[model samples]
Target: MENSQNQKQYWKENIRLLFILLSIWFLVSFGAGILWVEELNAIRLGGFKLGFWFAQQGSIYVFVILIFIYVKLMNKLDKKYGYDD
Candidate 1:
């Protein structure tokens, strides 16, 4: 029973992490790229419009970075739950 409860808690935390990460990805990809493109376009980055950059390369870069962050967070979570082996 205790093991089952532990598993439930672990799964809950994992889902929470996934939700948070995915929300960030969605906000960056959809919000900045599409919704706020005009506002972002007013700013320049590396000779490119910030909005265009986010639409093209920025989201991809952020996704990759988020992947790394998720991995690191999951590692810590695993250790916390005694699943790091």
Candidate 2:
């Protein structure tokens, strides 16, 4: 019973983290890439429009960084829950 409860808590934390991470990903990819594009386009990045940069390259870069951040966060959470592997 205790073990089951621990498992539930671990999963809940894991899912919460996942949602937070994905939300950031969406905001960067969709919100920055499309929604606020025009406003972003007013800014320039190395001769390229900021909006275009995010749509083409910035979002992907952020996503890749997010992957490593997710891994690091999960590892810490796992250790905290005594579920390290």
Candidate 3:
């Protein structure tokens, strides 16, 4: 029973983490790509329009930063939950 419960908890945590990461990914991609493009387009960075910047470069940078942040945060979360391997 204890082992089964632990397994379930592990799966739950994994699923939760996946969902959070996916949501962030979608926000950076689709959200910025479509939903927020107009607002972002008003701002400029160097020669690029903001929406174009995000659609082209900004999202990639944000994705990389997010990956590192996720790794660091997940490490902390793993340690907290005694799930670090």
Best by lDDT: 2
lDDT of 1 by residue, 52-82 (tens): 9999999999999999999999999999889
Model 3, 1-85: lDDT tens digits are 9868877886788789879887988888888866899898998888988888888888898899888978987887777667788
- TM-score per prediction, in order, is 0.90, 0.91, 0.73
Model 2 agreement with the true structure over 11-80: per-residue lDDT tens digits = 9999999999999999889998999989999999998899989999999999999999999999999998
Question: Each prediction's Cα lDDT score?
Answer: 0.95, 0.95, 0.83
* lDDT, residue 28, candidate 3: 80
Badly placed stretches (over 4 Å) of model 1 are: none
Q: Which candidate ranks first by TM-score, i.e. highest?
A: 2
Candidate with better TM-score, 1 vs 3: 1
lDDT computed for candidate 1: 0.95
Residue 25's C-alpha lDDT in candidate 1?
Answer: 99
